[model samples]
Structure formats: C-alpha cells, structure tokens
Target: MQVSPIGTFFGDAVYKYEAPRQGRLFAGHPGRIELNAGQNFEMALRDLDGFERIWVIFQFHENVGWRPTTRPPVPPKGKDRVGTFASRSPYRPNPIGLSCVRLLKIDGLTLYVDEADLLNGTPVLDIKPYIPMADAFPDAKAGWVEEQEGDLWTVLADAPFDAQNRWIAERSDFDLESFARVQLSRGNFSKGVFDSTRRRLTVDESAHTGVLAYRTFRIHFTYDDTARVVCLQRVSSGYTAEELQEGTEDKYGDKQLHRDFITLPDFRR
Candidate 1:
C-alpha cells in the first residue's frame, strides 16, 4: 500500500515541544491546510464546510525513529513508562498522526482550522469530517488516561506578567505564554513537582518561587500551595552580558534572534 500527501499544514508550532499535547487543549493559534489544486482536491472538499470539525491525518515529518516503550513528559511519578500504543508518543513505528481540529472556514483550496496540534509544514495525508454521532464516546473507559485526570492545575498571569510576555513575543521566536501554560498546567507544584533529573523546573521553598528554563530564558513564577495556581512573575534571559556583547549567534546559533531578545528593555531590567 502507498500513501501520498494531499496537502500541508502550516502553523506557528515550528518545534514539536511548542505544540499543545492535544488539539482540544490548544489555546487558539489557527492554521491552514492548503490542498493541492492540481490533484482535484477541491472536488473532494465540497460539502465539508458544514462540518464543525475535521480529522487531519498527517505525517510526523521531524521524527526519525521509534521506541517500543517511552517515558512521557508529564507522567505520574511511579507510572512513568508506558507502551507506545497506550500513549500519544510521537515516536512510533509509523510516523503518522491524527488530530481533530475545529474547522473555522474554507477558502478555495485552503482550510482554516483552529485548535490544531500539527507542526508547521506537516504533510497532510488525508482529511475526514468529524461526525459527532459516530465519534462521541462520553462514557467510554479511557484506562490509564482516566487515572491521569484531576491532575490539571490552573495558571493565572497578572497584568505585569502579561506585559512581560508581550515584550518577549516581540523580541523572540518563542511563545512564552503558551510554554508557561503547557508546563505549569498539570504539574503537582504544591508538593514540589521539580524533576531534578530533567532540570525542567526548580522550586525554591525559601522564596516560594519556581523557575522554568525555556531555551535561553528563565521563567520566574510563584505557585500557590493552597490555590494550586501558578502566577507568572517575570522572564529573564540566560545569556550573560559578555555573551550578549560578543554575540549569542556563535554560542546559541540564532545570533540575530538572540540579539533581538537580549536588547529588549525588559531584558535589560
């Protein structure tokens, strides 16, 4: 059997980590799937506009290989490892993915979709309309997934934090707000969820604060033990003054991009 790509998905999720774990959890970066006009794909898309959502079958272009068993990024402490089939691990025998994305509109050969988990330039193999009658399984047992429920925590950003996020957005390629939401949304921060092995987040009991490293920046925030909410305080560049002066491009690779971020007034502070 052979499969060919009918279209390609385009979005701001340039990196795998940048994408939301699930399409339904995605917070609003809309993308487009532009089908090949020469392949008569337009004819196939007819009457699909009425559907509220669509299932996008795409290729995981960036993933090179697979692992039989892998540890998930945010698994419950003792139940960290799981079979590939049981988890939505990107590394699979077949580098194929399916996402149920909200169909916002259709313009000619292009489909504007929201809540998309597809990365930029991901090859779209096929598209199918989401039928609620057949697909809805509200009472279906989800096994381990059901056990993982109730772990989700809330995140709140104050006005100053929002301002800092906006500042970072203008200067860097990173989506600071989305990254914070994804990292802090489900963790058991109250009991000290810092993973020393991964060094993703470091919690300071004395200061009642936590710091999460994202690329070349550190996200400083405070987590409320009782409220189970993470309040972002500020963002700081990891690059030293000498590194900024000498050029971060040689060290960090994205020279101009790093320079743009380090030179921001917020970074100076």
Candidate 2:
C-alpha cells in the first residue's frame, strides 16, 4: 500500500516504447532521469558509470484501473480477460511500471540511456542495475505476446519541438508532415486497417489540435483524415482525445520547455 513519485523524466522528448514484451525489446531510444525539486539527482548517479543496463521502476501515471480480462495488441482480437497481473497493460490498479533499459552514458545527472520504453515525464520510482542471470527467463512462455506482430521499441524522434514556441506564440498553422514522417519511421502507427485509414486522414481544425500530456509539447496532426491531431497524451491506463488536448495546452508554453534540447548537447563532459 506504499506509493510515491519517482524522479521526473527528461530527454530529447517523451517517447513511446510501442510493443515491448519486456525491457529487452528495445536496445535504443535513450532517456534520462532528473530530480524534481529537492533531491541531489547528480550524486545518486555518480557511481553508476560502469553498468550497462538498469531497471527503471516508474508510475503508470496514465493507467486507471485493472480488469480481470483484457486483450493484448497481439493477434486474435477477442480473448478471455485474464488476471490483471498476468498482462503488461498499464491499467493495473497500482499503475506501477518496470523496465530494464541499457545505460549508454551518464553526464552529471543526465543519463544517456537506450531501450527506454517510457512516456515523457514518467515519474521514476527507482533505478537498479540489471543482472541478466537473475532477470531473464529464456524459456519464458509468452501467453499471448508470441503471436503479436510488432516490436514496441522501434522508435524515432518525431513531434518536433523546434517550432513549438512559434506555434504557442503565433497560434498559427503548423504542419505535421515532417513530424509524422519521423514518427512513421519509428513505427508509431500499427500496420492494420485502422492505421491505414488513420494515417491517410487529414485535419484542419483548431479545437482538435492540442499539446501532449505530461511534458512541454503540442502536436496537432490529422488522423484518419477527420481533422484531429493524433493524440500524444501520456498516461498509464490510456487517454481521452479531450484529455490529451487539454494537457498539451495547459503545460508546454515557454522557453524552458525547449531548454533541454539545447543544453544537454553541450554538457556532455
């Protein structure tokens, strides 16, 4: 019954670990964990240079509840809903998420990581080194995941923050074409009939456009050609289109939001 907020997430941008079965699914897409207000985040990471991978205990901030049975993204859409603990869905009652990510490098409090399957600003609970012998189950039987046809770790940096200020300041139209291309490269959209249609859609409305949840960002793009921005809201359980739009507008609207992208590149020492 104990719970608390982990350190806030930071990096190029909040990313999606699309189809990770375990943390091993991603060997790239790095991230970092920074202190929220009072703690000394840098000191805690001072001795972490030698490790290759680490376990990240985080909150499924967007997950809402648990169900006795649920359908995974794998094949066979309808299946018996199993116990909540049996699946990796973020909707569990506790909403705690755990993943093992590779450690590429550490600069002060900033950690260059790989295989980070987390949303932007995910609250980190703790960091522990990965012990392969103790963690991996080579003969593990993936009850339903074995049939899934995709890898979640396949990600690319999309949703540009370059013109974020312009969009916020001018409230003018901004195109998501290049941004969408980047996301597509990372395999964000699934290869299904729904995806086929969703990707081809177009949007040209203001109400439908909004910022991403949890971080300083705003992405307004068309989905299924219905004039709505693809939802980039962050949550453990899931998000509503309205909620996603609201979060984006409420948070990201300043110069500090884009500071990391500029500062981190030069602080590598």
Candidate 3:
C-alpha cells in the first residue's frame, strides 16, 4: 500500500490544537488547497467548480500514535469514556481525516474552500464532490452522540469586548473573538465538562466569571446560569510590549497596516 499527497491545505490554523473540532462548527477562515503542478491536476478539476461542496480526504500528519480509547470533548457530563472509533479522535489507527468543505471557487489547480477544519500544510490525499442525495442522512441515528443534549449556547461580544479583540488582532495574528466564540459556544462551564487531568475551563466563585486560556491570551467571560448565554467581557494578551512590538512585524506585517486597519472609521465603530 502506498499513498502520496496530491495537495497541501493552507489556512490560518497553523497548529493542530487551534483547528476547530469539526467542519461547519467554528470554521471562520477560508483555506486554499493547491494541488501539485505538472501532474495534469488542472485538467482533473475541470467540472469540480459546479459542486457546492466537496469531500476532502486528508492525513492527520501531526498525530504521532494511536489510542484504543479516548475521551471526546463534547460527551455527556458523566459518560465521557468511549472507544476511539466511536469518537472523531485524531489518534486513529490510520491517521486519516475527512471533512466536507464548501467549495468557494477554483483557480486552475488551486481550490478555495470554506468551513475547513484542517490545519495549514495538511496533506490532502484525495478530493471528491459531495452529492446531497447520496451524502446526506438527516434522519439517521448518531448513536451516543444523539444521547447528549449538545445544545450550543449563544456567544456575543459586547462593544468594549469587540474593541479589545480588534486591538489584539492588530497586534497579533490571532483571532480572539472567533476563538472565544468557539470555546464558549460549547456551553460547558461546569467542572465535569473536561477531564479532571486536563482542566480547560475555570470558574471564579468570587467574581462569578469563567476563564478560558488560549496560548498567551486569557478570555474573560461570564456565563449566565439561567439564561445560558456566554457574554465575552474582554481578551487580555499576556504578550509584553516588546513581544507585541516584535509580533507586529512578523505575524501581523507592517505596523502601519494594522494602525490603518484599526483607525478605519468602520473598524472603530
């Protein structure tokens, strides 16, 4: 058995952990799949543009090994343990992944897609058009996944919070608001939401607040127990002035471009 990469996926999700758990969930950025040139790949993509969505078969190149049992992030509070095959855990025997991404456009051998959960530089093994009648099964039972409530909460950023996110985006390449939305929308604030060893969400009894840490930034938010709403208060970057200054050039490009973007009348509002 032999396999080779036909193309590579390029997107904002540079790290595996930063990618959304699934496509159609928190995919806020578009990505490009540039097929290898000189393989007649351009001719192969002739009629692909007509399809609205396509199936991307890719390899989980970052995964090192397989696990027989894994705990999924969104399992019901008490029953978190499940066989690896039952969940979409990346630590699979084959290390392969599948995603249905919306095909935005096609430029020669390059494909523009949205709702992609793959990380940047992910090797794409194959691509196929998605057929609605053949691919969709809305009424099919989803086993244990169906048993969970899986209710997504409403995530909102207040004016000040939005401002803080914009400020952070200008300084760094991170999308604070999108990351916050993805984390808080799970509505899993209780202690049992995550495994005891890997605690991702923490609540402060005194302040009635919950904090989700991402990289060097901490997202401050409050979860309403009654309303079931997660209000984003602000995003505080742990990067020092020197770190931010350095990132401004490397990650965010020219400082003037960021300044111009931040000062725009529309962005200011």
Best of the candidates, TM-score: 1
Clash totals for all models, in order? 1, 19, 0
lDDT of 3 at 140: 92
Model 3, runs deviating above 4 Å? 194-200, 240-269
Candidate 2: segments with Cα more than 4 A from true spot: 12-28, 36-43, 76-82, 149-269
Ranking by TM-score: 1, 3, 2
Sliding window of 10 residues with minimal summed lDDT for model 3: 191-200
- Highest-scoring model, lDDT: 1
Instruction: Assess every candidate by TM-score.
Output: 0.85, 0.53, 0.84
RMSD of 1: 3.0
lDDT of 2: 0.50
Cα RMSDs, all models: 3.0, 11.0, 4.4
**RMSD to native, candidate 3:** 4.4
Clashes (candidate 3): 0
Model 1 lDDT-worst window of ten: 190-199
Which model is ahead, 2 or 3, in terms of lDDT? Answer: 3
> Residue-wise lDDT of candidate 2 within 122-180, one digit each (tens)?
88888888777898798999776564443332222334433343333344222232323
